[model samples]
Target: MMYNATQKVISLSGGREIVIETGKLAKQADGSVVVKQGDTMLLATVVAAKEAKPDCDFMPLQVDYKEKYAACGRYPGGFLKREARPNDSEILVARLIDRALRLLFPADYHAEVYVTVNLISADKDIQPDALAGLAASAALAVSDIPFGGPISEVRVARIDGQFVINPTFSQMEHVDLDLIVAGTLDNIMMVEGEMKEVSEEVMLEAIKFAHEEIKKQCAAQVELSKELGKDVKRTYCHETNDEELRQLVIRETYDKAYAIARGASSKHERMDAFDALEAEFASRYTEEELVEKLPLIKKYFHDDVLKKAMRNMILDEGIRLDGRKTDEIRPIWCEVGYLPAAHGSAIFTRGETQSLTTVTLGTKLDEKQIDEVLVQGSEQFVLHYNFPPFSTGEAKAARGLSRREIGHGNLAWRALKPMVPVGEENPYAVRVVSDILESNGSSSMATVCAGTLALMDSGLKMKKPVSGIAMGLISDSATGKYAILSDILGDEDHLGDMDFKVAGTRDGITATQMDIKVDGLSYEVLAKALEQAKRGRMHIMDKITETIAEPRADFRPFVPRIVQMVIPSEFIGAVIGPGGKVIQEIQKATGTTITITEADNKGYVDIFSQDKDGLDAAYARIKGIVAIPEVGEIYKGKIKSIVSFGAFVEILPGKDALLHISEIDHRRFETMEQTGLKEGQEIEVKLIGVDPKTNKLKLSRKALIPKPQKA
Candidate 1:
């Protein structure tokens, strides 16, 4: 029996079409779909366990986005010729899909789900990231899994004062706003993008425009699900919840939790109060009774009672857990040049969140090389974020980088990347490392503030000073009432309806990320949130400017000195001799590092050294190699060799001139030895003339010497 292949096409606002086809491949999987736009194609497959593990409490969903080398018709980059770990871009795309779909899963349905989307074909014009989220959602739509999705993802870019949905790669270059928005038919679930300091209204309009196109794709997924007879989903009871225990915990803990939330003034104090209340409730139950019910009680009390209590305190009383009113920001303070040896350092503290960031300036040799299948290049600026367990008052051992760290670092990187000066304007490669010393709120935003200060402290002349703020939203869709929070605490982010972070300068937003937890989040609410965010960002920028108004006048003394120059492309090979002999010799002799590259038919050379002497030495060597000998110019020369007729004198590092016996002195000499210009001796010589046809220089020490009658 042969099954007919079904396909559906959704037209975007810009006339580009995404074709989703099913029943063509991967029949063994629970659900699979191939999504194609232009020449790019992505194959997405989703599989779920029949029953969840007994101990599972949350949705164990994992989404992986892989770009195969063969997809672009190229071999793998490394020596093994195989794809290895996922690159940063791929991990980011996978994260976008996970964030959008994770909230849409059924509350009690905790079966392990794995969604894998692989790029099998590539088109230079179309970006693969925009297609990844849609492919993942389509696979889940045709599956018999319990999901609230049939969602779609689209890339929205503002070009030439017009918004283009699903813009091609080339179109992105001209857009001031490049955002990827994911949502169901009614509301947006996730938004992540960078902009050129656009206004609040402009950003909101882009989102609204993206939602209109997304509605069509969502409708297509719904129809395809119906066609596959997957309108009804599978059932799985993963929770052994006790209704009686849940009510008892709520009844006993609601008032106590409310008091804890309302009375506490600080983060640690509020947390301690909540912890004591939970402990008090547990003490009432015996050890044997707790063996079966303590976990359930704790879960229900914290997740249902405590969560509701905290949210209500904000929604009803219009006060945050820390006793701040809505639209209020926490206290902020900043300091620069915190480290003596670092090229640049800053410490930014907002309420309890603190980031100690340092900036390291390097040469082009230090740029990070990216070897991903789709992208092969180097980045001159990089940002890394580190969050230790001690930052949150925990005692756990340190683990390597987590996805949260990567995500936060990426956000801060975007916020500050555009302000950094490019190649010729500033030739140093910059790396910023943000270490969270204390965190009770948005440490990622703290990173942005600290990074700006650090870059400025390092003497980097950025386009502008940047600051960031994280905004929180708590709302009730039924009542149409909500509170927009500024500089929200960690609790607010976990319990609120939205976690929206906006970063920029005084003009507009540079980067933004919003993850909406509640449904039916209207554009009006989003616009209000953006407006609130702007005020908060402005306040933070004021604090940042108070600490340091602009980049420093000079770098710290310990930083490496980098001098750059451009030479004719023809001399590049000569400067870097066969097997890199020339450059290596220069580095060995001058105690410096040299790197050269050909760009635009010119050789760009960067020389780095630690001391003034070393820098001057390398600089002189490079200047000599590219210099043209000027007649009548004087130079301190070393006699390389003496012959019968003349001696070769080294005038410059790489230049030599002929010094005849007669040119050595005005007096006549019988042989070259009579001139007494022995090898290993230094003398001052003048470039008198050059044979135009031979390109050979003629030097004379007699020109600089005083003659008996005419000097």
Candidate 2:
């Protein structure tokens, strides 16, 4: 069978080209495309159900990104040996695609849409995630699923003060700012990245730089769609609306919703009022009529009437739903040392949102090992975020970890990782867990705040404390009026045009994530939002510092202390013994945990214990094992066995030497039985010499005695 493949090539900076080909693979799907850059290839397919499910009011979009072990010529870890579930890295990539593509689908298009991007080939230098979003958008472009985009996503990295689009994995290592920006040909939609305390202007410059490349990629997708004759999309009726009933609902509910918005009630209180208003309107209709019209009524009342009223109230009156000014931040309160048993704990509350974060310190054994196809390493610092149903006042069972949790945790980790001490400065591995006790908006940002507090509370020597704030935008495109809100509420986040989160210290931004819902968002507006966010972050930072000025002076009494030392690389094997027997014995006898890793021709040993005596004992054992034997040094040796000619003495943990019977005393002895030497005895000995041929230690007890004592 022959297939017609339409290809479009986009030239990026540095003469790199991305080739996107469609109609060559997965032809049975609604749309499919293969995106190739260098040796990396991603097969992206999009499938949309022909009809929407009954009562489906929202766009049901699901995006899955998978990297095959075969792509990178590696096998999956663990006993199963096959992919079980999407890891955090894959989930984050999927989220990037979902956030960029979700808004482009028509609001009324409720059909189930699934976008799957699989990495079938891998390049060591090229990062596949930066290409995943482009593959997904290209697939959608060649499909008959009504999408308002041929958008593309690109990673913009700044190295040595210059912006590079779609930087290689190696180039990213030296980047001060790294961002993934997704956009259509004319408008930017989503932006997320971490930075090294970069200024707002620099961040804006990177975004603009990314958009230029996105425009090129998007144009290529458009050209590809035209070549494939897929510019026209399929038509479907996913919504049924009675024009009169919609008008009646709008007319009757608009004023009521506006009044509720102006009332400045709490989150739950406002929710109940709106629900009551909807019930009152639904009561006017008979039960039979409601069976058919109720869904539309609820949808219209919430989406059109209530959303518009809330947005307009903020835009026109400069009053938010919580009755605060456009730039006003919600109240904040914080506490540290909240959990006595934890290594560190803190509670940070901002308005209705609250986070209880705890920090745990561990040795290298507790470091998280990552074994993904493209990336493999261990992390000394980890952050996990949890959002429960009760946090939002919902009655639902808690499932396993969600993609949102991973994404949010990653952002917080990036925000605080820079402040964490590393290497010799921080010997213990750190894990931070943030659990949302209550939430209204920007819980992830709250996690950043609480994480800083908890880390400080745990006696971690953080470079600087980080605080985060979620900024919102309310704009009138027709009137050219807009407002940049600080510390946005949950309702503002849902109804507003933008949800921009900025986290950092007073120095600059460490991490940022922005999702723009509307089009034509100018750079000036973004700059304004960033500046407003800085102020809000400072306010939150003040609250945080007021509660706890800095990290505690020292770790809690129950926290285990780690003592680190270095030894010669050759001695590491002896210290560990054959099959770890020696190290295990030392740990068991001293009640300590010891970890040894060799780097730079040296073995770094970390001993952990809550008991000072145990720590000191383990340290001494390791020190003696690595200690070089000297010719004149004296040691308290333990006699292992008494032979006919000599006794075997262990001067160090594993260093055994022969103590000749002549060295036992100046007076000669005929036999070992005549000498008072016995096995399992402690005696003082001197390292007399080392055999040139065997490199063995020769010890003597008589050498330590004076001539007069011998006489």
Candidate with top TM-score is 2
- Runs of candidate 1 exceeding 4 Å displacement: 1-3, 13-15, 283-288, 631-636, 660-671, 681-694, 698-711
What would the per-residue lDDT of candidate 2 be over residues 46-125, giving only the tens digit for each residue?
99999999999999999999999999899999999998899999999999999999999998899999999999999989
Q: Model 2 off-target regions past 4 Å?
A: 708-711
Per-residue C-alpha lDDT of model 1 across residues 1-711, encoded as one tens digit per residue: 587788989886557789999998897899999999988999999999999987778899999999988988899876899989887888899999999999999888888999999999999778989889899999998889889998888889999999988788777779899899999998899999999989998999899989898888999999999988998998777889899889989999999889888885788888888888888888988999998888898789878888889888888998778888888888888999989999999999999999999999998889999877767788999999999999999989988888889999999999998899978888889999999999998999999999999999999898899999998888877677789899988989988888999999899889999999998877888888888888888889999999999988887777898899899998887788789988899999989989887889999899998877988888888888888889989999999999998899999877889998888887999987677678989989999999989999999988887887965
Summed over model 1, clashes come to 0
For model 1 the TM-score comes to 0.94
TM-score of each: 0.94, 0.98
Q: What is the C-alpha RMSD of each candidate to the true structure, in Å?
A: 2.6, 1.5
The lDDT of model 1 is 0.90
